[model samples]
Target: METTREGAKKIAHDSTVQSLNQLLEKNYDAENGYKNALTETKSAQLKPYFTKQAARRSRNANELYKAIRNLNATPVEKGSAKAAVHRTWLDLKTAVVGKNDESILKECTRGDITAVNEYEKVLNDPEYLLDSKGMIRQQLHNIQISLKTIRKLKDIVD
Candidate 1:
């Protein structure tokens, strides 16, 4: 016997958790994507950067996991299938396009852009809880910083 207000509250909270799970999935994708980049990256300079990015993604995923768990939802512990397909496409593109650090940088940047958009989507939703909003903002900020880092790396080599 839930009142209308209580029902609305539950709906909002559930949506917030759902949003967090979506973000978590992307973080997992980013983590694995970076790992794959590391294996394909030949540049000595880029390998360390890729490794650091992968670690950051993992940390981001952990935060999302805890956040979702706090809301009593089972946080998704696996990467999205879209990520594997994206990687495969990138691999094929690399064969015809460029295999150099420049090309890899482009691909990584694209992935980061996708991650940023996903975060932005949740941020734009008014239904999301405020506490989780703070965490999402921080993650989005970190992703932006990584984008800048990639730009700087490009400058050094170009």
Candidate 2:
């Protein structure tokens, strides 16, 4: 009968939708469960790294502060700018070395770039007449190249 055929079609459509809904629900549950597991796993993996990194960064910050203070005290002598930039590089290097999340190094390098920019402004100023401005600029370009390399490393690690 036509009524029976229509009823059968209705039932098939309902069955398909219900099946699809069940599949979707299962997928969502699986994703949520996996996300929770991943969070716990990552937390456990990261704790020791976090502890070491904090101590290292603290020491590096102290060194950086001392370098900056020394630079401030010295007369703006020839090659001082280059030396100061080198000191900044050392600070950045110290902070980032052996870090598990290499992105931390990239971020510190980015901050180094900012510090370089600040130093560059001094070199650019008419009154500053920073010694070895060209050398300092070249060193900053070198730092940029290092940052690119570090970024590549971060991509691979991540």
Lowest-lDDT window of 10 residues in candidate 2? Answer: 73-82
Structural RMSD, model 1? 1.5
Listed in order, each prediction's TM-score against the native is 0.92, 0.34
- Which prediction has the highest TM-score against the true structure? 1
lDDT of each: 0.89, 0.41
RMSD of 2: 28.0
Model 1 per-residue lDDT tens digits across residues 3-92: 999998898899899999999999999899889889988889989999999999999999999999899889987988888887888788
lDDT of 2 by residue, 9-89 (tens): 656444333322322232232223223223323345444433443343333334333333333432211223434464456
Task: Assess the local accuracy of residue 2 in candidate 2 as a C-alpha lDDT between 0 and 100.
Answer: 60
Question: Which regions of candidate 1 are displaced past 4 Å?
Answer: 95-98
